[model samples]
Target: MSIHLFQISLTQLQGVGPQKAEELHALGISTVGDLIEYYPFRYEDYRVREMHEIKDGERITIQGTIASLPTMQRFGGKTRLICRVTVESMLVTAVWFNRAFLKEQLTPGREITLTGKWEQRRRQMTVADSEFPDKGGAKTGTLQPVYSVGGSLTQASIRKMINQALIQFGALIPEILPAELLEKHALLPRRSAITRIHRPENTLEGQEARRRMVYEELFLFQLKLQAYRATHMKQADGLVHPVNNEEIRQFVSRLPFELTGSQKQVINEILHDMKQPYVMNRLLQGDVGSGKTVVAAVGLYATVKAGHQGALMVPTEILAEQHTRSLGAMFEPYGIQVGLLTGSLTERKRRDLIASLQMGLLDIVVGTHALIQEDVYFRSLGLVITDEQHRFGVNQRSILRRKGMNPDVLTMTATPIPRTLAITVFGDMDVSTLRERPKGRKPIKTYSVKHNMMDRVLGFIRKEAEQGRQTFFICPLIEESEKLDVQNAIDLHMQLTHALPELAIGLLHGRMNAAEKEATMATYAAGETNVLVSTTVIEVGVDVPNATLMIVMDADRFGLSQLHQLRGRVGRGEHQSFCILIADPKSENGQERMKAMTDTDDGFEISRRDLEIRGPGEFFGTKQSGMPEFRLANLVNDFEVLEQARDDAAALTASESFWSSQSYKELRDNLNRDAKQQTEPLD
Candidate 1:
């Protein structure tokens, strides 16, 4: 019978009551379809093996007959059950801790199988799981799926419920991938994949099932992105602006510094997109000091020269103000009116800025989220640029784009994203990368030290301050947290003030209001504060050329990309800058992160390692970074599969007949449904 598994309630399954249903819902399994798709994170190999064949320290499953009655021993707050089992004619001691109930089944001459780690010295086995041959739920000689359970649900219970759901509704599972696509990729049918993934007879079968799921996930994601691009191009209301090449060239020539080759090429790409019949959707990626701002200014200048307006949205007010000052000075000679609109603006100032934008009096407006306010309107907003694109959600990007008539959008990020993520997360937009740093920028020297070196680090900072340089002391937390052992900005600032009272110290964090943060940053930027103790709030877009020192406390608490970003805050000028990571991390991952910081100053390399260590989920807050959470696909390890899937998705989206054909109706419907469910950006 035909059915929609998604519409069937998980509570309808046997033994799943309201409480259990609520628990499952918390795990993102509310419907029967979600339950079936809830694949296991790993599996247990319980295939029976002979004791003599098993290697020392190897975890193996052995079938045997009970050779002796079980004996129980009580200890301090713990109990142990010991029994002798004859495995392949050899007697081995099986031990189970705190499992007193197992004694009832460990009778003499009873046949059973035990899976555990074997110690050859004592010929003893630490039984992790045991099952009798006559048991109903025996998982012997198979790969048992292990799921990630939460609340009161055990792995056994989850597995049981999944089995029940599959047995009852397996026939209703529809194939999401088209038949031709599946055959081309050699993917299993959806129903078979679901079944084998949950209960595979062997490791190879399980891997094949996992491969199918990974490809399906990546393909579906790419399809949505491609479809979004297609829909936008089809409804293209883009304006074809006349290119004033001479004027733009003159503006570029007027700059004090010469443009690099990469910058010039990227500018050509942006300018070319502007002249196209379709709206330009581009992502500009650059390292922290790679001169992305200059390239963005050129794009904005092109829009203004065409008698249109532009708006740049940043994550923080301080960055917006910094951009306003720098861009305003650069455009002053060119007669371009640039305005700043932030939440900290006074009422009269905000009103006047809004009026100027609406009247086309402002050529380029740089602001925070305040630019997307309801009262703000632009007369001819032709270009929209967002700095630190990962900071904003997809919906926020769409909202800002909606402010204009299908404006050519340019999103910029200083965070060096790996090539794999760049293609998948932003498959909808064209990409422009600037790898070459601006001329004459020095590499920042980095070091990792323990907490005991704080005194020496402080002495070095004092010397730097004496040499007429600034320093930034970054903490992970704004306020003191009892649960965490890391340094807090407030306490660090206080201690530093006492330790180095001679140097002027200032505090900055996210807890402060926008106005206060702006004021604090202004003082630090203007050299009034020689030492600024702040949190990660100053992680991005806070450019201080004279600041030659960066000290990060508890650096292990941060990801590699973040540590790199913090390090990038310095090394902006020609001076020999330094970044000291103060962390005594115990975990191997943390140690690797610290070592990575001291090894290289390359942002791209650090980001690649970050993806490998933290995976894609924590690459940059997956929810906010616009990265989809795939069940079986890994952006780092499964790059090849992802590439193939992307190619197939591109081919499928380019076919107009495929979308309209009756054979592909189900796939089209699924695509539309997925699109409606997500809050994806239009541009």
Candidate 2:
């Protein structure tokens, strides 16, 4: 009759049969600990309304009586009920479609309270999701928790299960934070917080509980990051590539374009890190097309010149191939050999390449995750760089790092996170940013348009194609999805082909295999495909300089950084590139994203706006190497708490007793587990 804490499965709980357990498991709540962590995404305040306060477009509660029986009729195979409810003195029409069953509840002189949205234009109110209470039964104000449900799950069911858990195991949940720390921050105890989160008595209590949960989440995250840094710093000496080598200087001098000051400054920082004895674990952050690849190439060349090998791991095969082709061309005159390893290589050719790498015949190598295969080996690898590293998982980077003995690690990201967010997210690594685009790269012209201007946009793309340029149409989905109402790549491609039959259009998405994607991209890059229709899968490693127009459908569905990346795909080419957003977003946040994209082409500014609107958990999602969904914390509102947690972690970790204390054994174990569970991407 005892609960085993985090290990106890949800199936063991009362009334939780196999079907119920499966539903919970789908939501990542297989165990008691996960259930405790599955906080509600939102809460509804059930405020009882005064009848006089009814207004158009407002959600209000009305205490009323059914003036007469509602009229039920069938219209086009659907039943509808119409009634006039008397609220105090005003009688307003209430309608329900396909709910003739509710006609029984609208008996004459029946008294009730109804809550729903009032639409003035429709001249009626709907009761689809409204809550009702018996009239004169003394309605009570309350708050209800609404969870993210799917499949067979429902919000009411989840709330019921959580309340059951609170009754059974709430008090037994252990507290990990020190008493002094809790008192200093005015945080509620762990047990009290969990109970209040599930079943709070009032609004104020719920806020206090949520605040405590946010603080704990932030504190644990910072504590683990500090531990990871401490662990990494204790590693053995790393290989050094002496800075200011003649080969490096000569390579930079030979490039076609001059390096911007920001690029130069970042190169200095990276070179300085490489020359140091300790492992150079640095993050290179730049906006899309800010010359990050060139800097990475220079670092790789420096390591090769020092008589060591270099490896660049990218996320996709197309990107890997592009880097290999470009870097091979750039390094050929310098006598440094560049190699490629990918899933698409034939067996014999791949084996020969592996042998050459093992024998140190190749000076530099570019590859997808294939480089992390067991057979791949490097001869004295000194530097490891991951391109668009956000596309990679933390373990993938660590595995590549293990290929070389304490190699200097440099991770690059094109997402321009604010400096403050960067500190909290990548606190374990030194950060260098490239804030400038290379000279001669024209700023992209962005325009936001509604769906009504579709024909005009199509004509614009046709015009660009007539000039021997290309265009990209980005959709949010690879195929039609039941849940998502946005356009899909397949549907868009078909529609575009019908609209412009003369132009050669191509289709690309993430679901396409390595060979298929490569072929599709090849045709597009060769200008044979005048218009390429794709999903956001083309977000990374797609370079078509001749492609001048990027039209994103459902543009509001994408984050600002993501939209910027898609916009970047077009502006890479000269000829006054343009990005057209086809959108009419329904939500305020979506409208904000659309406005931000049209306001400026600056990635950093867009990123700041993205973080503010979407929050950090989503800002760093799966496509961009996000951490776990934070249940409580706001990266913007709680930035001060983040700073405090970071300071506390650093100060506590520096203390001798921090690791040795017996009281922190559970906490230490949790930190290690969290570090392994989350992917740490460079911002």
Candidate 3:
């Protein structure tokens, strides 16, 4: 049961020194266990066949002896190594290009095996691989694993390393999965799966082996997540807030706009969770301009009505100020006091705000991560809400939740999470989605155009500005990067100021201090600036109703999800909005992303395509979002396996037998070990 052997470094291997070990580590193989799990991306079948049975353009292996001495010939800087081999009583020419080193090995009457593409008409084989059979070459007519090797590594060298690992340590791999679970799924044992995956005799064996490994990875991952959910539920007792429907209805009636059906449904779900005995851990998903804030306001209102406080956390100070204004306007009718806290606030003002929160003088408070400061505390923190939830780390969310003893937590995001991630990354929390935008919202018209049409687009912008409408000019960077050819916000702002000298322009980017960002955004929001040139900082919470046009420079530089978010910024107003994407994408994938943006305005569809194109890691901005990088199991292609694993993990985690039985000891140990390594919260 000792894992000491598996924990040994790859440097212990015969030919692996520090440099070679570092290369293996780059492939996620630092230990023997890692080496065994480093499965090949593909396999080649080199079945020895008779020369008569070979067909044109087919890759075949033929065994023969050298009939004539190998000769090197040069023709106009192109070198060829040619030899005639005797195969099945016939002489067939074996050809290799730029392989002068093979001449020393191909001696007359020497026995060798050649594998290459065969051309029936030429009576020749273009040798792709050759082996000296009597000198411990691999057996003919067997499957060979083709690993994805890089940087001073070759296929044969990797094959050799894997073989050495299997021979020395494959059997020592502990079977941590419970026997019952393995039998129920008909999975191969850990040892056999590793061996078959690396050295399968046939395709079916390889596939089955892969299936076992994929399931094992997913099962272990889900076990940790589900265990966290179950353990937390058992340990924490949540506040039960009173739901006053008549009061909520009266508040909704006084609103300026009618709530969409999606909004009302989500409000009901959140309110329903609030009144429950346990704490609310729910995710609110809606596209940009889906009115999630109003629904969230109702929840805060309900909490305040129950004589408890509410807090909303956002990623940016500008968003906090915006939410405070909007929510303050809504809550004023009912005499609910809302306060704002931010890093930019003076020390005296911040102290006063903290004192107000501690004294229970404020009904609701909105702030940036400044809300999670060690000194910040709430007297009766009943419900916790986070806007742009993906921007905050799990630890930050957890810290905010800890401010209240089992407060109902409601997190909101404008980024539409794909279904695969909804089940994996957020499987532990209850989810409410707002698919329909509020009524009277028009679809944003999107276009992908080349740089040559910039003059025409600029003229259109001028006409729009003349009509008293505003524009948002988006750039990928704050300053022009030497490696990237995209326009920058500072230079763009200057250019627009000169070219359209009649219009007022304002620039905003991350490099600006918090007060500067707020002031610049304030000027644009108040109609003092006709164009706001900025980066993605405005992608989330800046809601300008009059801005009707969005011009994104070098649109191909952004991901599909990001492009969708940026597009969401302009279409908030009733005026017919247009999103102009300017770029000349060089890669096919880049071109496809641009095309997908122009084709549809649906956030969910865009997210699905984004998940497929850029994958889960980049889809969620994995580094900041804490999305796990899986090695074998793909959330998109292996969705069925993921679901099965999730269901099984949940069932097992919820079962009393799993907790009480000794048969599950090893599995329990694995779950505990994984829990120790996990820094992200279950939500």
Candidate 4:
């Protein structure tokens, strides 16, 4: 009677023929174990109710006798069924749209039960679910699981299939979780949890099942991340180069303004990491105008002073050029040689830069992914820094690290992740935060407007342009498609160019070539182009101090962090900048999101609220980003579970024989299979 004795084949399920089995395999539900773990998205309750007590618009079940024979008719290609029933002398009408078969099932003078929403229309009590009493036996007071289904597989069909499978395999249930771990987490037995989740007798049972499964999923993911951190820390040892603050002090002393307290604190943290024996894999997270670049420059200066090279990798050529120009100006006074390399550079220029980089003549090289190309070699690479770390994957970051003998890594991001998520996802790296903006920087006045205010907004823009100020118009899409998003870059550029031909208008999008993009950005930055119309491609780079006006059309289509980044493009100058979010205020969610933008200028607050509303998976694109994707545990709604799971994982991994434990073995096998199964079909 061992729990592990269960070994039911999926083919044994009723109505699951070979073809259906193959189709299920395509969705990665090939075995009983996989099917059991395929959790439902939501649940439905089917508790019965008294006919007289049933409230209007409330879905319920009431027993009644048919007063009149049901009538079925087709109206405008849609079938409709209507019938009258009596419950204790109270007559109630039931109507069903597209359920004509119900007319024959509920005949006159027959006692039956109806389950659906009761609606009062034109002084008549009408019910919606038009089904007979015998077919209503599936009703349960507990939460009924609702799953995601595809073509031809309705919810009822899926429920029936799963029920059949469960019935056939019920006696063969297995206990996959270790007894100690289950007890520690107060998790239910695996077999009982799975059974209850699909067909719960009560709401509490269903909730307990969900809680247990969520904990298991999050615990396993945290364990994997913790194990990765532990393995990397033990193997990759970093050289601790003591920081000589003299060089950084000299550079800072010549600055026009004093560094903010937050900036100085972050620099101190970076300096401390540089003195540590472990490799400095740290993320410098700050708001838009928090001056993360200067902190990173300090790290570069310190690394160069330690007799090693540093490389700053940006996502685009324009960002690379901007970083190179700024860093060159900052470090040249200290005699630090900074070089720029990009894909758009001439062959001869790139070759010359590569030679200097190999010869160790370039102390710091700032560029795009070109810095990690095979042709470019670093002589004494000591530190590697990447801006907008989310744009690159782990393998790409590892490739850059391979340039040197385990170079200390420093990653920077303007998108401020929540503290809890940061600790879990980036547990391997130390973190530094710059929370304050530089002095004299004005907060951009943000407003949400509808399309009707387009003309007025343009007029304001014209005024700003006349005053020698620059403007940026951000569009959600690059080109005109048949989509609902009407304000695309191409169309908007044409409209604006025609409207304001007196001012220079330039276009920048992802489809444009590198040279074209760089040229357009350069024209805008140099004040040659007074207006720039672009897509989200301009979200990361193209910093212009003269651009004082920002307008994002259909701002509701953009994420909070993306909108914040686009807004960051402006307010870099002294003039009072404005961000106009043009969106339809009729949509509640859209209004709520844009209101968040208009209310606060804090990027971290926006990100936190975004995570709370949409969850971290959507905020960071964790599924596509190759980070651990959870099925049930949401970082926002299930915050407690996430924290507990992380703690449990840390404790379990700290044990000497943790990796050799039965639970760890199963978890590792599951992870390996998950990775492999992603490449090919399940079958």
Candidate 5:
């Protein structure tokens, strides 16, 4: 009756052999409870209609008498069973391809209810799979649940399995949701919901059952997130040194350029949170070229000025080196020392950097995951900033926190997330977004070109390279994949070399070692490489101001946010930047992305469209992005339910007596499991 019962093996069930059980397990259904909860994707109506009333091309069920004898015929390498049935007075021709066995079941004067698409022009139907109804059965007006099946399982096989389950284990079903909560939400009883979700007696029963399942999934998820938020907020921030307006003014004025209004507003938010008693768990989201680095430096500078150290962790060594150089230029003038520690650094150099940081001589350290190993120590660490935060897992971020006592964490993500997702996923942290681009920055012109236009695009790239500007040729794969039609970096590099032999070409991918990638990036950065062919490895970093053109091959293969990130690689300089997307995708989603990329340069708007097109799971790489997958609840369609559930969870968690209540024991256990199952920094 508890959660463990849900894990009972399907092999123990009747009519299930080892092979069938293995096949079922492949679909994530290895237990009796999982089978019961496997709700239908849609319903097929067996409600027989008049033959004359069946519309053309509509899947219909029609009842008729066998007025004519069934005949067998041979077609092009296939068998066909032909028959004529009289429905009232009209004759309908039914053709079942490769189903000569149906002739034995279709005897003269035998009445049958058939389901297939109607072809009114020829008065015939190519019948789909059909089965005979039971004696005294009247299923012509009922709905039959049609589940999504795979791995040698048919609808009938699932039905037989469920029928056996309902007979054997139906009486033992225990309610997971508390009775009071069920009453408040007007949800169906647990057993009835399970029964109707699989084999509903009518349309209304199925609808009610589905609603309850969705509500249960969403409510539990919300509860887990709320608990995490409460626990996170309880952790006290050890560093609360206040840097007032004068210090902030000095820091901002120290820069060569002026700060944007949005950037100033976000800094105020970060600074206020840092000065609070609790740690500042904040995600600083901004569009590309929106001056996030300056604001982050300001935050770190304030922490360092307060006589504490800081560490800025990035995903790539190239980006970390870039950050070290940029931060050093700004901090050097303020008498603050910045250290660059990466995997590529020599052992002696790394040890020296670590000793300097441990001795309090280094004001801030910028590096990759190399900053979090056992030997790397920081003295009085107050702030930790992670660039391209999503690239690192939640555990990776929290590991840095342990180096210092609840250091204020600031995670920077250039992907502009929609508001709904920010509230749901980042519920544990306060968010500050940089919305406006820096002054004098130009928007990159975008184009969605077909494969045939590559000649013109190649010509343009050559022209740009000849003008002393660089171009990036981005492919989705590192090597050519037979399964994926997208161009690969290795082949594209060769192709570009042959096409533009006068200019130098380079290759970059994630598979390359740190030193190899760094050297390749260095050559491209130094203007020695005119054309850089790479994968999404250069999505976040590899900021080359001279790189003004971006040509993405098979652009339709990427997510919208990824495409936008690739586009951000360019347009970092004063020259007019352009993005050429070469793709001819077959799906509607592909077409939508192509149009979105070519239409405008608004990251926020593009993300909103992306979220609408591909729900939360795909938008954020569900598991990898530190988000849980829902079995029933949809983030887009059930946004209101999600909000309501969050409110309910907050109230439930805050209630003093609810924790000790006997009725909520199962829920408490589930919450604990959910917590341990998915631990995230800003979940």
Candidate 6:
């Protein structure tokens, strides 16, 4: 398939000169195909309105006679147009800011239709764009698409280009889906969907078109992910390690506490996967204090008992060191040699560990990214375990796998993601959940307060510290600036140290050097520091069993999932813990978010509710995280369509006879073309 289509040539569009084309290209609209595929983020319903039924901030279309001729006046040397209109005995004022030439478009006593939001001020009604309306009564009651464009590109320009593209190629769109699959799924043909999306005759048709497109995109994406997983599984050569029940039983018996049923279930699942001939690609998802680490440790011990080496890769050096210490204590009693390798270690120490690893003298190795370095070769790496797997990309995981003879992977995450999102994001991996906390862990009491209650919050913190319990004061920013964020780490550190002069205070953030950060965390972990003021860098792996309090300043600035993870830092010990959320936003969503935190402690429930309230993109930090950026589909809002698409794809792929069909070939070619286009350089 060629990159260029008959309608994709922007040079052929009316008013899209080379200069304008370049501007459009910056918005990811280099061709007509791009314009057509750039689906609307939302629709504005302006199809029906009455003069007497006008509400404030309601987008409406109304036709009326001009009560007076539009007049232009100069305000601060900028021209403005002011006019009045009457609709069904209702009078409204219209203002066009800095649009002097618009007055000519509206003549006195001329009947015209206007589409804009109604505003009520001082018992008067006003419309922003009342002076200019399209010719055909503004096509009332239809869904109007809103495109995401750059500041330089106006919505009108996008609408125009899309309309032109549809007119040029709407009838020529080749159907790519298999006919039987489309029929079974009740999906619209490609041509009809594209046409209706660009130029719908009614709201129903527009909705149908959008549903079809969103489903198709989601289905194809899931299919690609599943195919990748299947291909990898078929080609991977894995070592089959039988379960060592005695080793696991010994480790469990030595522990002071008993494992929950959920923990035991997860351990059993891992053992089952290890006994399989194919490699294991699994994710262990659990909430804070769920004892997932111990489960992973048991899995590591089983692999080592089978005479194979395992590597635990963590995102941060602090986490790696913590894991090394915990695992070393457990394995040492059994005569298992465990080595620690991190970037912060001395050159000589790192070299020694690497030599021991290569010589098969080490049974288990734990480190950060240093473990994946080419110089650190494993004797017989069979299992690769990554803590907080979301922190690393797919390529990084692949690099670690290449180090061993196709090692079985077990990635763990404490972030309790919703089921729908987890399936969509990690559809390729087998999933196991540890829903139960340890036997003796206490539930953390949570509270949401306003900024005015700072004195009370500080008093509570002082009381906890006086009891010899550690506390964490988390901030969203590193330094105080002109923004509305709470006090920065430096400012908060100073204020807290001054307030609690008798207590030890420390600071930690991403800006600190590795040594400085490790030292600060070590002091706090060692119980030498009573209070630690820091940022979100501590959200992941700074575990202190003595810490019993978490104070999140300006909680509105952080996402619900992130706040949940931050709250997880505490409540790890037997002592009663508390997560204090201080947020003061006047918006309804802000208030609702604060209330939601106080209402529930379950991370997965919070994640689902957050998706419902703020959408999936915001819940996962999609813009920054660089997950699949869909132009047409919303993962949260269109989940039903996504599922339908997945079913449709599965049905189509299940029939072996369809692979040789013409429709199948066309679909494959179209998918390949779309994949190529999606991956191309932006310019």
Please report how far candidate 6 places residue 132 from its true position, in Å: 11
Extract clashing residue pairs from model 4: none
TM-score of each: 0.86, 0.68, 0.85, 0.84, 0.83, 0.84
Number of the top candidate by lDDT? 1
What value of lDDT does candidate 5 attain over all alpha carbons? Answer: 0.84
Residue-by-residue lDDT tens digits, candidate 5, 157-227: 98889878888888777787877778988999988888888888888888899888887777777677677
Cα lDDT of candidate 3 equals: 0.87
**Which residue ranges in model 1 land beyond 4 Å of their true spot?**
1-35, 50-58, 64-79, 85-91, 97-112, 131-138, 148-172, 343-352, 393-399, 476-498, 501-529, 556-560, 584-592, 608-627, 673-679
Which of the two candidates, 3 or 5, achieves a greater lDDT against the reference?
A: 3
Candidate 2 achieves a global lDDT of 0.82
Distance from true position, residue 554, model 2, in Å? 9.4
Pairwise lDDT winner, candidates 1 and 6: 1
Kindly list the per-residue Cα lDDT of model 1 for residues 265-374, writing each as its tens digit.
99999999998879898999998899999999999999998889999999988889899999999999989999999888899999998999999888899988888888
Instruction: Give the alpha-carbon lDDT of every model.
Output: 0.88, 0.82, 0.87, 0.79, 0.84, 0.79
**Models sorted by lDDT, best on top:** 1, 3, 5, 2, 4, 6
Best by TM-score: 1
lDDT by residue (1-683, candidate 6, tens digit) is 12455346787777778988888778877677776677777766656577667777776777777888887888688976777888778777776677676777778778766676677553233444443344554445566677887867887788887788778756556666667667876878887897788667777888888877877777777666555555566453788998878778888889768899999999989988898888888889998778888998898998898889999989888788788888998888889988888888899998999999998999999988888788988889989998888787666777888888877889999888777777676666778998887888887899988899989998998899888898999998898778565678889999998888998999999888888988998899999999999999888866899999999998888878788899999998889999999887675776877787889888778787888887766666642232476768877777777777766665665566545676578666655556631321100
Candidate 4 weakest ten by summed lDDT: 674-683
